[model samples]
Target: MTARGYPKSYALRRGVILRAAVHTTMLASEPALGGFLAWDGTDYVLNNADGTYAAITFDGSDIVGVFFDAESSYNPYVSGGAYDIEIFFRGMPPRLRSLAERHALAYNRQNYQCRSMALITAAFWSVDDYLTAAFPWEDVFRHGAHIVRVELLGDTDEAWQEWREAYQCSPGQLAAARALFWRDLSK
Candidate 1:
């Protein structure tokens, strides 16, 4: 049985299936269902030992939101060091279900891009790092700021303060870092 805070009634009506993100990952034991991931009972950390798991969040015939996590998420960008993934659009009408699902998938694509910096060249740590690296992601971050409302952040703010307090800035280094840090990242 799917646990509480989970969907108990879902029969794949109209090819729309809602996946739940249960910490226990008991959903994996069910037949034909794909793998999954869930929080560790001890902490919010996604436990590797127990394998991927999640529980459905509805019961009976009610059509609630689908609860899901990295394992069940079709987004390829998710499993890549994205520790924080919370996409919720509840209380929407059933007619908009398709649109809601699509938005949920894309709600955090920019977030994934932000986290991907950690995996890229070791030189890129924060805005300071990007400045030091000749300001990569210039176009993406710039477009993000200039066009849409996107918050590009990492350790840049804190690093800026630290740099202000700890050491004097060279004109070139400061300018380069500042340009990428202040301008390119945020509009």
Candidate 2:
């Protein structure tokens, strides 16, 4: 099979910085923000950004992975800026998104403890693991990352219970999943 994503010729220059097309427009236009970034062979320099940078692993020109510190705020929501702070791998092979969505659906359907929108969302985000391994560096070049938070809380208890039964989700499982979701968000 042919390798996908960024070609084998892209190189990370130490002092080079590129303007990131941040999906959040509010965070992209601030001049005093942390958009200015530089690669230090380990992590990115925030360059006045409000948050920390995640460690990016590159194999020659291909991005093998991104390592976020457990305690560091590497996500754009926590970080006030967007440029160089957020990286989305859209060119991570065809059907990667669909595959991840399928995986999430299957996982929730099979695991009672993971039957929640939160876990599904997490699964979608975690799809980057597969993308990094299979496609590499494509997140940086291609753009198609869109995240929508849909809170489908039924209007009534009976409705909610019916929906849960239809989806085969247990109340305890949903509670645990919600806890996990909050934990990740609070982190």
Candidate 3:
């Protein structure tokens, strides 16, 4: 197992962030949002551009094993319909894991996955509320890092149609789409 306790093959290196666009069909508008995308412990966060968040776990990079916050209703309606999500693994110390474990123990007693979207949404909203209540938006903005916006285009066939239509791409350009997911550097 790796230091984070994931199987050797499943472990992702520290400081490497993988960003992906997820076209959410589950939403009424099928909104596309960026996923800050990290694999920590058994969970991953799909941090939406509007400050909303989703938590999930994978059996492998391609197969989602569980969706922690699957039923959340809070969506941050950011401008341009684009969202930025950041996963800050560098700052999460061991104490945070201890706190999370304690949270998990109490949480599991309720017969729900702590990683679920519903729970994560509550956490996100709680944090946002606390920030807003304690400080001005400018103060919060100044303290927070400037998140880079990235397009999280969905890989689904239907999502592809929407993306193609929006980008006005020709067949040739469409052919290059597969290249986007391939990590040439891994070679």
Candidate 4:
């Protein structure tokens, strides 16, 4: 079940351009890389919907995650750099990652899950007037946001499949999901 292996150890070196701990102040100056997901200890660090880092507790159902290190400072991979990228593989709350693994590409959770919610909203477009009120996304979204444990929802394939059917994801969405599916965090 170990998707990828991590470095036995990572030692900080001089002037390492990217991949520093999250606390590095220089991260602000570095060009924005796409969101970074990793471990800052036992907890998991995820890019929140609002452009902030979120730390989620782990459960068995979470998708595989990674932690990269050894850089003198934290620099997101998107910041132009020549250094080799190494990752320490693990997991946390795999909410989005889980969807990606399921090939639900267009289901972005960014910006308060707007993209996902939009898909659900679109599903309503196809709903009959009588069943329109039966759209269940609100319950799903609410449970995801309010529940302290991801296990209550966003924890199984069945839940995601329902959303996938409701949204009627496009080919682009499938591609996106496949692209984001798994983290190859091996050294």
Alpha carbon lDDT at 159, candidate 3:
44
**Residue-wise C-alpha lDDT for candidate 2, range 15-98, written one tens digit per residue:** 112111110121333443344433445323222232222233333333323322212333323444432311333444435444
Could you give candidate 1's per-residue lDDT for residues 9-104 as a string of tens digits?
222211111111111222333432232232222111111222221111112232222222233332334444443322232223443344323322
TM-score of 3: 0.27
Write the residue-wise lDDT of candidate 4 on 1-187 in tens digits.
Answer: 0112111111101001112221122234433423444443333444434422323322333222222221222223333343222221122124534432343223322222232321111111111111111224343223121221221222235533442443344555533433333221222
- The digit string of per-residue lDDT tens for model 3 on 85-134 reads 22222233444334443432222122233432222212211121121112
Q: What is candidate 4's CA lDDT for residue 77?
A: 31
TM-score of each: 0.18, 0.22, 0.27, 0.21
Displacement of the residue 91 alpha carbon in candidate 2, Å: 19
Deviation from truth (RMSD, Å), model 4 = 21.1
**Of the pair 2 and 3, which is ahead by TM-score?**
3
lDDT of each: 0.26, 0.29, 0.30, 0.26
Which number leads on lDDT? 3
* Preferred candidate (TM-score higher): 1 or 2: 2
Would you give me the overall lDDT of model 4?
A: 0.26
Candidate 1 residues lying further than 4 Å off, grouped into runs, are 1-55, 65-73, 78-111, 115-187
